[model samples]
Target: MSPLNSALFKNTTNDNIVHPDYFVISGFAGIPQTKYYYVFLCFVYALTIIGNTFVMFMIYIDHCLHSPKYIVVFNLALSDLCGSTALVPLVIDTFLFKSHLMSFHACLTSMFFVLGFITVQSFSLAALSYDRCVAICFPLRFNDIVTNKSMSFIIAILWIIAALAFLVAVIYINKLSFCRSNVINSYFCDHGPLHLLACNDNTPSTVMNWACQVVIFWLPVIFIVSSYICITRALLKIAAASERLKAMKTCTSHLILVAVFYLPLCVSFALGGALHMNARIINMSLASVMPQMLNPFIYSLKTDEFRESIKKLYRRKKMHITGRNT
Candidate 1:
C-alpha cells in the first residue's frame, strides 16, 4: 500500500473495514476565480426553481392542461425542480460557503439523491418523447393509447426504477473499504469518483458505472430518437402540406428540449480526453443544470396550450388586482 492508503487504513474498524471520517471534495481545486462561477450557478438554480414551479402550477390550475400529454410535461417539470434542488444548493454550500468536507454517510446520501433525480429526469424526457410519438403518429387513438392514469403509472415506475438502481449503487459503495484517498474529484459525490477512492475490489462499482450510463443516458437517448423517427414517418403520411406542418409543429418544443439536454452532454463526452480537467468539469456542470433552467421556457413559449394557459392565468391575476384597486 502507498503512504496515503496506509494512512486511510489506520482508521479501520475491528471488522477490517476502512471508513474515512470525511471526504475532501476537490472539484473546484486548481481553478482560479470560482466565486463568479458560483454566483452563476446560484442564478441558474434560482431560474430552474422558478420556471419549473410555474410550469407545474399552470398544469395544476388548468383543467384543459390536465391531460395525458400535460401529465408527462408535469412529470418533467417536477423532476427538473427536484433534480436542481438535489444538486445546486448542496453545490453552493460546498463550493461557495467553502464547506467541502462531507461525512461518509452524507456523501453516500448525496450521491443517491443526486443520481436518483438525474435518472428520473432522463427517463422523464423519454416519456415526453413517447407522448409526442403517440400524439403525432396515432392522433385518432391518442386518448385511447395514453391516459392520465397510464401516464402517472409510467412516471411512478420510472421513479421506482431510478430509486432502486441508485440505492443498490450506494449500497455497493457502503460495502467498499476506502483505504485510498478520501478526496472525491467531481463537482458532486459522483459514482465514478467515489468508487475510484476504494482500496478494495471496485469491479462491481465499475460495472455499475457502465450500467448507469446505459440506463441514465444511452437508453433514454435511443428511445427519444426512435420515437422522433416514428413521428417523422407519420407526418410524411399526411397528404396535405398544411396538415403535415400542423402535425410537425407540435413536436418542435420536444425536439428543442432534447437537443438542449443532450447536445452539451454529447459534446462533453466526445471531447472528454482532449479537454482539461477544469474545462470538462465546467462543461458537464453546465450541461446538467442548463437544461433544467431552459425546459420550462421552451415548453411555455413553444406549446400553444401552455402559452394559452399562461395568458389566461395572467389575465385572471390582472383583473383581480384591478378589482382590488377599484
Candidate 2:
C-alpha cells in the first residue's frame, strides 16, 4: 500500500502528487501496539495538561508563588500547555481515530500556532535563565530587578516576538503557490512539510526557516548556556558551605532540565536542510512532546509548595467525592 494512498492522501484535492512512501514519523510510530500506544499518548497528554494547569493555578491562586521565582515557571507552563495542545491532539486524531481530514487552511493555522507557542516556550526558558541568574547572582536586587511588572513586560515581549515569527512564515507561504502534493508527511502541517509540497523555488522559504530557527533556538540557547556558566561560577564563589550547597541544588536541577529540553533541539537543528523526510518527522515529534512531558516533573516536583498544592488539590477532590457518596 502506497503511503500516499493512505487516508491522508485521499483528502488531497490538488494536482500535486503525494509521495507513496512518506509516512508521518510521530509518537504513534515509536510505539508498536496501537491500543497501548494511543493509551500512553493519551496519558502523556492528560498529565501534561493537568500538571501544567496545576502549575498555572498555583501561580495565580496562591499568593506564596506570586513572586518572580514562580512567575517564569507559570509563563513556561502557559507556553507548554498551548504548544502541546497545538501538536498532540492533532497527532492523536490522525493516528488513533484515522481522521486525516486536515485541509490546507487548517494545516496552516495549526502549524502557525504550534511554531509560535513552541518558540514562546524556548524564549521563556531563556527568560527563566535570566531570572535565576538574578535571584542567585544579585540577591539584594532580586526583588527590585524581577518585579511583577518587569516579568509581565518580558513575557509580553516574548509573545510578540513569537507572533512575528508565525506571521512571517504564514505571509511567506501565503504568497507561494502550493501546486505540488499537499499531503504533509507529518501529522500536523509545519512549514517544512508544507514547503516540501511547494512547486516553486523554496530557497527563500528555506533561508527564512533557517534564519528563524537560529534566532529562536540558537540565540536563546547561547544566552542560556553562557548565563548558566556565569551563574554556576558565581554560586561557587559564595563562601558559606550551606548557602553554596543550596545554590548548587537549585542550579543543578534547572541546568539538567535546560539540557534535557534543548539538546534534542540542537541535534535537530544541526541535521539542517538535508535531513531525510522521515528523520525530520521523528525529530519534530520528539522535540514537541518531550519537553512538555518532562517539565512539571523536573521543575515543580522538588519544590515543597508545588508538591503540597498537588496533594491538597487531589485530596480535596477525593474528600468531596467521598462525602457525596456517604
Candidate 3:
C-alpha cells in the first residue's frame, strides 16, 4: 500500500457506509512500545499540573502577589492547566491500553481545549512582554496606566478574543464531513490530523485554521519579541549601571518563559506537525510540558519579591499548623 493510503486507511472498516462513532489515535510512536513510556508521560503531566497549580494558588492566597505581572502569570498558569488537561489524559489512555480509540465528541472536545489554551498562552505572553516594556520604557507612567485591575482586564479581553477565534475554528472543523478514515495520525485530535480526515472540500476550514494559527500564534510571538527589543533599547539609555541591572533582572523570568513556550512550538510548526516531531513522543511531551513545569521555578528564582512572598506564605502556614496542634 502507498504511504498515504497506509496511514489513512489503517484499522478502518472496508464498508463504504460506515460513519465512524469512534476514532483512533496512531500516536507518533504507536502501540506496544508506547506503553513503556506511559509512566514517564504521566509524570510529566503531573508536574505540569501540580507546579502550575501551586504557583496559581500562591498568587491567589497572597495579597503581595496581586500585581500586574503576577496576574498575567496566573493566566499563563491557567492556560497551561487547560492545555495539559485536554491532551495528556487522552494520550495516557492511548498508551496504557494500547487502544487509541476516542469517541467523536471526545476528539472534538480535546481539539477545542488544546487549541483554545494555546491561543490563551500566546496572547498571555504577549501581554506580559507589553507589561515589561511599559515598566522599562516608561517607568514613571507605568503606575498610571498598567494597574493590577487594568492587567486583569487586559487578560480578560485577550481571553475573549482567543476563545472567539478558536470557537469559530472548532465550529468550522466540526461542520466538515468525516466519512474517510477515523485513524488520525496523532497522539490526540490535533488540527492537521482532523483536516486530513475530512473528505469534503476543506478549503474553508483549512483557511480558517491557518488564519487563526497566524493570528493567534505567530502574531503574538512577533509582538512579544518586538516589545522586548524596544525594552532593551530603552534600558540602554539608563545612566546608572546598577539601575540597568535591576531593570534587566525584572525581565529575566518573563523572557525565559517566553523562550520556553515558543521554542518547542516553533520546532513542531517547522516540522509540519507534532505527530512528526523528530524524537516522537519524548520530544513532543517535553515541548508541551516543560514550559508549564518550569514557569513557577523561573518566577521564584529571579523575582525576589515573589520569592519572599512564597517564603512568607510557607512560614505563615507552618505557624498556623503549629498553633492548631498546640
Q: Of the pair 1 and 3, which is ahead by lDDT?
A: 1
When 2 and 3 are scored with lDDT, the better candidate is 3
Clashes of each: 0, 2, 0
lDDT of 3 by residue, 1-326 (tens): 35553443322343422235778877755435555577777887888888888889989988988889889989998998888887777778776776677777687778878878878888888999999999999999998989988998999998888878877877777667666677776677877667767776789889987888797678998898799899889989999999999999888888898888888778767775435343654565667667767877788787788889888988998999999999
lDDT (Cα, 0-100) at 292 in candidate 1: 93
Would you list the clashing residue pairs of candidate 3?
none
TM-score of each: 0.95, 0.81, 0.87
Candidate 2 root-mean-square deviation in Å: 5.3
> Candidate 1 on 1-326: residue-level lDDT in tens?
67764654445454756888888888887789999999999999999999999999999999999998888889889988988998999888999899998988899999999889889888988998999899988889998999999999999999999999999999888878887688888899899878998878889989998898888999999999999899889888899999999888888998898899888879877887798889888888888799999999999999999999989998999999999999
Best by TM-score: 1
Lowest lDDT 10-residue stretch of candidate 1: 5-14
Per-residue error at 284 for model 3, in Å?
A: 3.3
Cα error, candidate 1, residue 313 (Å): 1.1
Give residue 308's lDDT in candidate 3 (0 to 100): 91
